[model samples]
Target: MPTSATLAQPAAKPASRRGFLASAAAPLIVPGSALGLNGAVAASDRITMAAIGQGPRGQFVLGHFLEQKDVRMVAVCDCFAERRAAAKQVVDKHYGNSDCAVYRLHERVLERKDIDAILTAGGDRWHAVMSVLASRAGKDVYCEKPISLTIAEGRSLIEATRKNKTVWQCGTQRRSNPTWKFVVDVVQKGRIGALRAVTTSFGEGPWRQTGVPTEEPAPDPEVFDYDRWLGQAPWEPYSKLRVRLWRVNWATGAGAIADMGAHYFEAVQWARGNLLELPVEYDGAGMFLKKPGINNIPYFYNVRARYRDGMLLIMDPAPKGVRYDGEEGYIHILDDGRVEASPKSILEGLPDLSKLPPPKGHWNIMAPHIRDFLDAVRSRGTTVSNPEAAHASHVIVHAANICLRLGRPVKWD
Candidate 1:
């Protein structure tokens, strides 16, 4: 990884994953409901599960886990009381049992020995933090996108997952979609002629921080441990926007390009046949709106990077999708499950289209990806959206964010 004046190290390790779990042992007791699951045992068929960061995304991911008879969601954690309780309710309701444990801190969940794997859908800052800890604790991980807030954190996260031999999958669920696979295969196999460029877009986000509270509030330790949510992020006074709206802030997330563009460029990397390599250089300009919607992340931006292979990736303002241009034609992929190619007959160009996978029923977006993660857990196989690939795509846009932040184009080493 290259050093930059734009990317600075945080003051210190907020807390070591191992150290936090070890010291919190006395308080983080296993819930009585989790005990005596021995009767529920069905050999290795079941994956004992714990969930952290039970917000909207957390609750959603945990619901998918509970749908499987082979998954036992023993514990869940969230900084907010209402959300965590809501998660436990979902678990308890599913199994018709209150054996599910509730937690405010993720360290408690990590300290538990019962969980085989952890499903995390937390804030962008906590993604890398908890993934590293979960890896250290000898558990597989299913984490959300923009795996880390910065390129440096992503590199370290890759190290942890690789070292622990953890079966890790990022939450860029499109990778599991049969349509996306077919597209990647087509692009990689040169069915679209020689690939030349990729155009990805996510429209525009709130440029001006509005509809959010700007005043820093006193931390309500009882209602929500603001400090815990702010972990790994620099210490700052509690602002409703800072905690909840942190997703778009550069301090806590990589803004739209890395956070949302993660999906777009990741597929670009997949089609480009270089998932782990980043562009050698990138240049970009951004519109830093003075009207505040939330934080400092650009409300709108554009970046262009040239991969070493001379393939160009352009992210411009438009609808949310990736369009690949090649000599044969252009293929456009959207998140809503729309894939289009030029000449109309390009779909027939694939000699093995019959051998390619059939559509997996109706695409719910999250379902297939969850199925892949659970299957990997049972079979100990690699997931299609493993952490390594996530990291590579992450760095692509993360480097772009740096360019916007530093107000200069960057040369990535």
Candidate 2:
């Protein structure tokens, strides 16, 4: 129930569970599952996790984490009471127990030392700050993408993880998909000759807010913590439309370009083999909706960035995925897990695409990615989509967004 300002204070370190167990007055009866017997993961070997935010996307990703046997989801947090209750039900159902804790404030979840990692699938505004707080609390983070609202916030997250030695995984799961791996491999192997350009499509910009109530309505305090939900974002009057379409507003989200562009840009960065570098110049232009409303994001846009090596990265209002263009041929990867290459012969010598296990769904490629994060958490290793790569990819999107907003070109040193 604390305000966001009060929640900013450092959380108290959790008491050691071992100390408590040693001083117990009564002997404890342990189940076979708790002891790792009967084909169960041992209590000590399991990774305790908590989830923040349980919207549709949050619930989808949380379901994947629940599928991992080594991950024990103990808590669920959200600003919405319904979401918290629903998420707790799912967690309890998965473990067949009613012990899953639920909280309205994320700080309560972060204060628990028993939680080894935090899954942040909240709004774009909360992604960076939540990850920073979790890292400082000595918890690993698996955060959904467009991980930060701004380049500065992204850098702050990178620093926080490094300082805390936290294993952070950005939710750009494409890196773990075998299909994407194959695409990157082919491009890296020169099957496409020299990688001269990369092009990707982002959805059309957000439309102007219309057909919504003009007057601010009082929010139900018990049902939703509206103040906390707007954390770090500029204060605006309560509107269901605003909460529903937060991604279209500049305060809470960067736009369609950032929402979907982050994935495509990450792929482009991976293909270019420059996850740590930035393009020297960025130029973009977009058309804005003329309607009078809250939504201010561009409705159409075409953005371009030039790497120092003269290679280009282009993003426009097209379809969903990326294309790698080279001297000899080009390869295009769509969101539906479909792949097309020009001169078709270029795909001949590569690994047999037919042998690869087809993905369950477009976004269902999350299980393997979650597995990678859990492996890294146990081994103290790095994940495929670490903070550095995430930040680099985000920088490109943020810069392009800036260019489009400014209606001019921007340069990076």
Candidate 3:
């Protein structure tokens, strides 16, 4: 593994393609389509990109990137051979060429000077570390949610992106949903009156384990690099269940709260106008599986947190989404893009959601969010789900987890 100092060293700048073409001894002819003719974006003008982690979620997001005309995905990296191959096939098919490169290690992808951005959708264990490394390599990042396994890791990612002047967009796609945008607008515009409390739901947790996992022989390195897949996670005996269900394990993932909580919390923060702030106090209780299997995360939890301004936030396993309560009325934003409100009048003046354009495709509701990141990358601007907001959201969940594990209240600084 490379040290932070080594990876953080500034990468050498690469020569521009136009400059190289200009200096070529022989005159090379190129297709008009390659130079932005016939409504196609020019190769030099497109954002050169690569992807790390080609699991189901990763591939899903990669599909969105493929839809963008201004994004050129040149490479993909994954520890699993099948995943990388599948991702490469998709990329190649989209471009009608076999030019998409594949690698098992992410460092190889990061070393490419021509790549301007990276899309990291690996497990929770790899999110922060990979983003930090990509930032150090001068690559903008679009990372999946639950961006860190711990508060410290989240903080490190924020610091690295800031130090490297990287543009990062966390995968909290709800921020781009029209319903959510309207919710934030309503709250911020004081339609809900002075916001007093928020109740957000992140679904149920891991199942209880009944038996211990037996150690098994690891797979061949070519098939799956188990060691690299674990990344910063502690070494554990090779077990298929561990890899398949990493979210239930403490060492590799942070369970339901960190998984879904990231989205809900970010929504809460945005609606409350506290994107850069964290709660000052946290208290929670969790029901952990008493069995001795690999699963250690809680099966259910309820957390109560308070911001410095006395606003209350509650995280629980019910309600299916987020609900904001104010002095006058309350508004509820459901997980399926449905919005409900009390006294009914609070929703009267809201925009007609039915008239807005629907999501592009199945499971591609995040298209707008992805577009936001790519636009920011091109213009050197900030994204809605930027690193600071991501870190703050991660800290909220990690702090709640600590309180639950300690069975005591935790005071934040």
Look at candidate 2 and give me any clashing residue pairs. none
Q: What is the lDDT of candidate 3?
A: 0.86
lDDT of 3 at 266: 90
Instruction: Write the residue-wise lDDT of candidate 2 on 337-374 in tens digits.
Output: 78899989999967787777564576577888999999
lDDT of 3 by residue, 1-413 (tens): 65422343455578799877777856778988689998889998999999999999999899989999999998998999999999999999999998787888788888888899999999999999999999999999999988998888988998998999999999988888777788888889888899999998876644454346678999998899999999999898888888887887889887778877888889888887778788999988889877677777777888999999899999898856889999999988777777788878887877876765453331248788999999999889999999899888888889998998898999999
Prediction RMSDs, each to the true structure: 10.4, 5.2, 5.7
Instruction: Score candidate 2 by lDDT.
Output: 0.86
Clashing pairs in 1: 208-291, 208-292, 208-293, 209-292, 209-293, 209-294, 210-293
- Using TM-score, rank the candidates from best to worst: 2, 3, 1
- Per-residue lDDT tens digits for candidate 1, residues 29-98, read 7644445455554535578888998887778777777777677787887888888878888888998877
Note the Cα lDDT for every prediction shown: 0.78, 0.86, 0.86
Candidates in order, TM-scores: namely 0.84, 0.91, 0.91
